[model samples]
Target: MSLGEDGPGTRTRMPEQHAGGTGRRTQPQPRRALVTVVGVVVLLIAALAFANRGGKSDGSAAADGTSGTKAGGAKGSSAASATAPTGQRPVTSKTAGIPAGFAHSVQGAQSAAANYAVALGGVDMFNAGRRHEIVATVYAPSVSAALQSTLDRAYSADAEKALGLTSDGTAPAGLTFVSRTVPVGAKVTASAPDAVSVDVWCTALSGLAGQGSTKPVSSSWFTVSEKLVWTAGDWKIQSSTQKQGPAPVNGDDQAATADEISGAVQQYGGFTYAR
Candidate 1:
C-alpha cells in the first residue's frame, strides 16, 4: 500500500480504541472495484476543523480479487515476502543521510509500525498539538509540516461532536471510546540505505451512534504501505497509501456489545507492527 496524500476532515469520524464505528467486512461479497482517487488537497475546516475525519468511501479496490502475499504480483507492484517475520534487529547502525539508526530486525520494524499505526489511528489525532506531534513522530520530514497543519484544522472541535466525541474524543459515562489498530502482517517493499517501505495489513476498530449501525466495528483487512526514512534511530513516514485488501473469510464470531466493544478496546493495547 502506497498513499498519494492524506486529507484531513475527509470523513465524519475518528477512530477510538474500539469506537464501535468502522464499517463491516464480509469477504464473500462481490467485487466492483471502487478506486478512490483522492485529489492532492488538504482541507482546513472553516468551522469544526477537528471534527473532520476519514473513512472508506463505500467499497474500495479489492486486490480486485487477489490473495494475500500474491496480490502485489497481479499489479506488478513489488512487495516483501509475506512469510512471518523473524523479529530481529540490525547490528551497529543503519544510515540515512542524517545521523541514522534502525532496529536490526523485522520484529523491530513491526513493533515500530504497529505503534505508529496505533498513534496514527488513535483518538489523539483530534487535538491540535497532539496532531502535530503525531504527524511529526510518524511521518518523514518532507511530508510532516503540511500534514500537521491540515490535520490541525481537520480534527477541530466541531469534528468531535459529529462522532459522538467530546472536543477531545473520549467516551461518556460508562461508555468507553473504542479505537484500535491490529496488525495482521508486515512485508518489506523496498529497502535502501536511507529509507524503507513496508506494507502493514491491519484491522481498524472505528465508528459511533447506536447499538445497530451500518458501520459496526467489525474486522477489516487493508494494507498500509509506508515509506519510512531512518531518522535518529527511528522510522518516519515519508508517504503512505492504502488499498482495499487481501482480506480473509469473515469470521462467524459473534460481534460484541457496544460496552463490550468499549471494554475490549480498553483491555487490548495495540502492538508496534513490523516486518
Candidate 2:
C-alpha cells in the first residue's frame, strides 16, 4: 500500500583538497545524518500515504442495519462487470495492489474488501511472520499492533505443537503445515467513501490430512465479515469477525485422493472476489 520516492541521485566524490600548504589531507565527509533523515522521511511519507489512502464505498448499508445483509450488484456499480480481471491481482485491485480501491468510483470498496479477504484468509496466515504481514498490509494501523499481539498469544507454542509444527509454525520433516482459504463469493454489506463492510464466504483447509497424521486436514465453510477504512491510500481493516456454517452438507461420495487434493491446491488458483 505504501509507495515511496526513489532514492537521491548518485553522489559525486570531491577530489581531496589541501587544507594547508602541506598536503593537509581532506577526509571524505560521510553524509550519514542526511541519508538517515531522508530515509526516515521517505518511510514516513510512504507509511502515511498508504495509511490514509481513500477507498470508494456506497452509502446504502447503515450502522443500524442487520448484520450479514448483502448489497446487490446493480445498485452498486457497473465497474466490475465492465471487464475481466487479469493476472493474480483479482478482478478488484485492477490498478493497485494491497486492497487499493477501484479507480473509477466510490463503489470499488467491495472489491478492495474481497481482495483483502483472500490475503488475510490464505494458508500463509498461520505463520507468525505471515500473520504480521497480513495485518500490516491489510489491517488499519491502530488495531494491527493489538491484533497481532493477541494472535501471537493465541497461536501459542502448544497450539503449534498440537498441529505437528514447531513454535514458529514450520511443519515437521516429510510433512506440510497447510491452512488455506478458498474464496467463494463477496458482497458489500455497507459502504461509504471512507469506509466499507464486506462479507466473504470461504472454505478453509487445515492439517496435513495424510497418513499417520492425527490432525488430518478437513474442510469447513465459514464467513468473514470485514470492516474497512480508507487509510494511507488503500482500504485497511478496522475489524473482522468470523462465523461457521452457511455451508452445504457433504455428499456421501468418497473423499478425493491425497495426491488429488494436493494437486488441486496447486493447480486451481484462488480468485479476487468482486460484486
Candidate 3:
C-alpha cells in the first residue's frame, strides 16, 4: 500500500518484499500515509474546537459566554498572574485515564493542551476502542460524541491496510506499530477564563518496527494548536489544528537499527506532559 496526504483514505497495492538476509535495508518504500493520518487527527480536534466556540461572543467576560481575561493574565483577565507555571501539579485526578481537575489558570490550560496533544497523537489512536477512550477523556463532553464518529471514519480500515496493519488496526504479526508525540514547548495564543488557545511545538515518531520492516520507525515535526475550555473542573479540548513544523537542522548522530529503535520504544514509557 502506498501512503498519501489524505491519510487513511488513500490506498494502493502493496509491493512485494524482496528476498533478503537478516537486518537487510532492502525494504520497499514505507507508506507514509500512516504518518499523515497521525497528524491529521489534530485537524479533527480543530473541527471540534470551532463547534465548542460557536455562539460565544469574542469580547469580554460580560459578553455572553465569553471569559474576560487578557493574554498573560493581566489584571482585567482571570488569566492574569497565570502567565507563569504555578509549580503546582495541574491535576489531582484522572478521568477515564486522562488527567483531570486542572487549575483554573492560564498555565493549567497550556499544560492540558500539551498533554492532550501527546495523547491524541499516540499509538492508541490507531486502535478503535482506545481511540474512543482518549477522545472522551480529553475532549469536551459536549463535542466528543460527534467527534468519536468523525474520527472513526477518519481512521478507517482502508487507512490501516495502507500502513500494513490489519483492518482492525493491528500491526502485522512480528511487527510493532509506533506512534508517539513529544512536545518541545507551548505558547498561549489567547487566554480567558472560559477559553484558552495554545500552540504546542512537537515532534512525532511513527511507522513500524520489525526486521525487514519497510517503514522502520521514522520521525516528523509538527505543531498542534488547541482551543480548550474550562469544563467540569478540567480543561477539555474544544478544537485543534496541526502544521508542519519549526524543525531544526538534522543532527550528526548515526541512526540506530530497527531492533534498537523498537527496544527503546518498549523500554521508555511516555510521560504525562506539563507545559
Candidate 4:
C-alpha cells in the first residue's frame, strides 16, 4: 500500500497463527514500517513550514510603508537619498564671484562644500591675487589670514614655473591652461545647527592645452572634505582636505585636439553647485 493511504491510528491485519504452533499473535512488521515512514514525512513538512515563515516575516517587515527603512534602518535611508536630487531652488547670490547664501541645513552644507571645492580647484588659485581673494571670501574669518599665508607659500613662483606657467601664474604664450573642478556629488557626514562636515566628489582637468605643450591637459578624480561653520550669515570653510578618488577605469575615446579642448573650455561656463 502507498504511504499515507491509512490514517495514523488505522489497524492492519495480522497473519493467522499455524494450527499446531503456539497461539499467541504477533504484531505485523509492515504496520510498524508504515508508521515510521509517516512520522518522517510529517516532521519534514513541519520543518519546511517553519523556514518559510521566518523568511516571509523578514520580507514583510521591510515592505512596511516607509521607503528604504530595511534591516539597516537610518543608514539604508541615507544611502538611498544621498544622490537623489531635490527640486529646491539653489542659492541665487554670489560673494567674491563665488556662490554664497546657502540655506542653513544639511543640503546647504553639501552645496557649500561643492561650490567651495570648485573655487579652490580653479586655475585662479594659481594667481596670487585671485588666490588671496578666494581664501578670504571662502574661509572663516578666524582662519582666513593663516590659510592665505599657507597657500601663498604653496603656490609660490617656483610652483608656477614647474606647472609651465609664468611667475605671475599666466600660461605660456600659445597655450591655454586648464584647471577646472566639476563636482560629481556631495554628502554631509556630520551636521549641526552651527557647523557641518561635507565631502564633495569631483573630476578636474588640469595642465596646458595647446600645440607644442609639454603638459597636455589631463583629467583626475578626487574627493574633498570640508568642515564648514555658520559665520557672518553664511557657510564658510573652517578646514579642508582632499584625497585621490574612487576613480573609474579610463574610457577608450580618442583624445580631442588642443585647439578643440581649449575652445570648449572657453565656451562652457562653470555652474553654481547645489545638493
Candidate 5:
C-alpha cells in the first residue's frame, strides 16, 4: 500500500499476491493496511492543526485593530482609526464664549484641552482686552492674573509693529490678519477624579494676507500639553506648554493667492472640538 499524490487522507490499494496452483488469491496483508490507515490519520491530524493555527493568528490581528494587510498582501497602518467614539453628548453651553460644562471624565478633559488650545492661539490673543478675557475664561483663577500680565507685555505695541500690525493688533489697510489654531487630535496622558493632563496636536495659520504683503500667511504644526483641574464644575487650565510637532510631510499642492487665502479664512468658522 502507498499514499496517493492528493494532499491528505488519500488511500491507494496494494496489489494482491496470486496463489501458485489453486487459482486462489490472498487478502492484502492486514499489517500493511493498518499502517496505511495510521499514516492517513496522522496526515489529517496535521492538516487540521495547521488550519487552526492560521485561524488563531487572524483572530489576534483583528482584535488589535491597528494594522492589516491590504490588497496583494501589503501591510498598512490603521492607527488613524484607532480612536473610538465614546457616544457622550458634547457640551452645549459656553462660558465667556468658550465651550464649558464638560463631563468630569477623561474624554471631557481632552475636549477641554483641545478647545483651550484653540482659544489661546486665536487672532484675539493679539488684542489686549480680548486676550485678557480668553485667559480668564480658560485658565484657573490661580494662574490667570499672572498669565494675563505676561501676555500683555508679550503682545505690546512694539511686537505688533514687528509683525506688520497696527498698535491695535489690526492688519494694515487693504490686508487681512490671519491667526488661527486648529486642533488635530487630543490624548490624555494622565487622569484623576478631579484633574487630568492632555496633549493636543494642532496646526496653525498666521501672518497677513493681501497683495504685496511682506508677511504672507503660513502654516505651522505644534502640540500643546495642558494640565487641567475641575473648578466650579468645569475644566480649566492650570498650566500649559507647547512644543513643535509631529508634523506630516508637506504636500505639493499649489499655493493659493493672498486674496483667496484671506477669503477662505473669513468664510470658514471655527469648531468646538470634542474627543
Candidate 6:
C-alpha cells in the first residue's frame, strides 16, 4: 500500500513599493523549483513509510481482531475458540452434506462462517456439479439461485486452466486436485438477532499435488469476512470477500518433495472447523 501527501502549501507575497514618485516594484524571488522539489520529496517519504508499514510479520493476523496463524492468537490463547459449545452438539444437521443449523449466537455464527470457508475454498469448488451443491447448501436461499450462474461465469475455463484443472474442472490422469482451507480462528465484527459479520483467518493449500506436476501444492494466508443471515432455522452465507495475509514468518523447515506433498494430502483427512 502507498500513501499520498498533499502538495506543499504556497503563499502569495505582495510586491514592495519604493517611496519614489516613479513607482517601482520589488519582491523576493519565489523559489518555485525548490518548492516543487520539496513537495516531491515529502510525497516520496510518505509513500515509503506507507509501503514499509506492513512489511514485518508481527505475529498477528489481519488488523482489527482477525484470527491469524500462530502470531494471531495470544500465547496459549484459545482465541480460536469463540464463545464455544452453545450447549449444542456440533454439526446438528447438514444441508447437502454440508454443516448447517448452527446456534443463533456469536459462537454459532462464527462456527458457521468457519465451516463455510472450508467448503467454499475446497477443491469441490472447482467442479461444476459439486460447486453448485456446495453453494446451494451454504448460501442464503434468496441469493443462491442467482449466485449460481454468476459464480459459474466467474470460475470460467481460463480460471480452471490457471489452477491446472481441465475446462470442466477435472484433474489430469494420475494427478490429485488439492484445495483446502484451515481456519486459524474466527472473530465476530458485528452482530444482531438476524444478521452478523464474522472474519475467518485461514491458511489455504491449493494446486495439483502429484508426480511431474507443474503446479504443486502451496500455502497462502488470507482473511475472509462473511456476512451471514439467520433464515429458515439456520445461518446462511450472504456474502464474503478474501484478502491476502498478515502471514507469519517462514521457518527453517526443509521443503517437502512433490511426491511427499501428494502423499500427505491423500493420506490426511480434513476437519470440520467450528468455534
Overall lDDT per candidate, in order of appearance: 0.44, 0.46, 0.57, 0.57, 0.57, 0.55
User: Which digits, one per residue and each the tens of the lDDT, describe model 3 over residues 225-253?
Assistant: 77788887778977666655577787898
Per-residue lDDT over 1-275 for candidate 6, one digit per residue giving the tens place of the 0 to 100 score:
11111111111112121000000001110000100121111000010011211111122222222232222224332243333233434655667666678776555677788878777766666667977998888877777777666556656777566656778876788887766667776766655567766777677676667888886666767666677888887888776654457588978988788778777777766665556
Worst 10 residues of 2 by lDDT: 18-27
Model 4 weakest lDDT span, ten residues long = 21-30
- Where in model 3 is the C-alpha error above 4 Å? 1-42, 45-86
Once superposed on the true structure, which residue ranges of model 2 sit more than 4 Å away at CA?
Answer: 1-107
lDDT of 1 at 242: 52
| Residue-level lDDT tens digits of model 5 in 1-275 | 11111111111112112100000002110000000121111000010011111110011111111232212334444233345544567678887677788767666777788878777766676678877888889888877776565566556687677768889978899998877777777655554567666666677777678998887877767666677888888889876655556678989989999999989878777777766
lDDT of 2 by residue, 126-178 (tens): 56776677667776777676666655554566755654666665666655445
Clashing pairs in 3: 1-14, 8-159, 45-240, 46-240, 49-238, 49-239, 69-77, 73-79, 73-80, 74-80
Candidate 2 colliding pairs, count: 14
RMSD of candidates 1 onward, in order: 10.5, 19.8, 13.4, 32.6, 31.6, 23.5
Name model 5 segments beyond 4 Å from true.
1-84
3 against 6, candidate with superior lDDT:
3
- Comparison by TM-score, 3 against 6, better one: 3
Model 1, runs deviating above 4 Å: 1-101, 104-111, 209-216
Candidate 6 residue pairs in backbone clash: 59-71
Off by over 4 Å in 4: 1-85
lDDT, candidate 3, at 41: 30
The positional error of residue 57 in candidate 4, measured at the CA in angstroms, is: 38
